[model samples]
Target: MSCAIKTKNDHIHTPRDFRGGRHVFVNGNEIRYVIYADTKKGIVKYHPHPVRLKKGSDVVYTRTLKGLVTVEFIK
Candidate 1:
């Protein structure tokens, strides 16, 4: 599955334009944007939503320089 993004696929090396929004397909589905952030570590966030994977646990990860922002789908 793939999300519909206006960005050019060949422009992967360029920095993402924050002013422009992009679509992200997760787990073969086009999920909504829960949150976005830029940090040395991976994307992280918290919400009142329910996550079947964690069973109501905080999700965290270390992000790399491959992409401009690292996003975490919190439950």
Candidate 2:
């Protein structure tokens, strides 16, 4: 799946600004981020990176139908 960061009202952007690292945090939870290698000209199939869930983070992560992961922190 791919990721898009919602910066402003009409300025949504892809995650290309982030390099290779799990340093992409949405709501205090870090997500595993990777630039899909098949993003060239005419690739159909995308081999997503292996999903490695954080073992014991106090956050609830949920996957949506639109290929985006949303995180809700536990209080």
Candidate 3:
């Protein structure tokens, strides 16, 4: 499966956005799931939340001192 990492403020407007095993992380911690969904307030559904990487998964993330987030996958 393909993996992606984006900033916490990134908007996921549709369920299809999660198709490639995308996972959102803030300050180096993965977000498990959005606790609640409020359609009236413009919250998207979280039923198909992104899958979390396993402990030994070949995942790498880097952030600059200025807070730029970068994600990489190692073979």
Better of 1 and 2 by lDDT: 1
Off by over 4 Å in 2: 1-11, 16-22, 34-62, 65-75
- Report the C-alpha lDDT of model 2 over 21-43, residue by residue, as the tens digit: 22323334344442332222211
Reference-based TM-score of each model = 0.25, 0.22, 0.25
Which residue pairs of candidate 1 clash?
41-63, 42-62, 42-63
| TM-score of predicted structure 2 | 0.22
Predicted candidate 3 versus true structure: per-residue lDDT over 1-75, tens digit per residue:
545566554443233444334444334644334332222233322223344444787543222121222222223
lDDT of each: 0.35, 0.32, 0.35
Off by over 4 Å in 3: 1-14, 34-75
- What is the full ranking by TM-score, best candidate first? 1, 3, 2
| Candidate 1 positional error at 4, Å | 18
Q: For model 2, what is the error of residue 37's alpha carbon versus the real structure, in angstroms, after optimal superposition? A: 18
Which pairs clash (backbone N, Cα, C closer than 3 Å) in model 2?
Answer: none
Choose 2 or 3, whichever is better by TM-score: 3
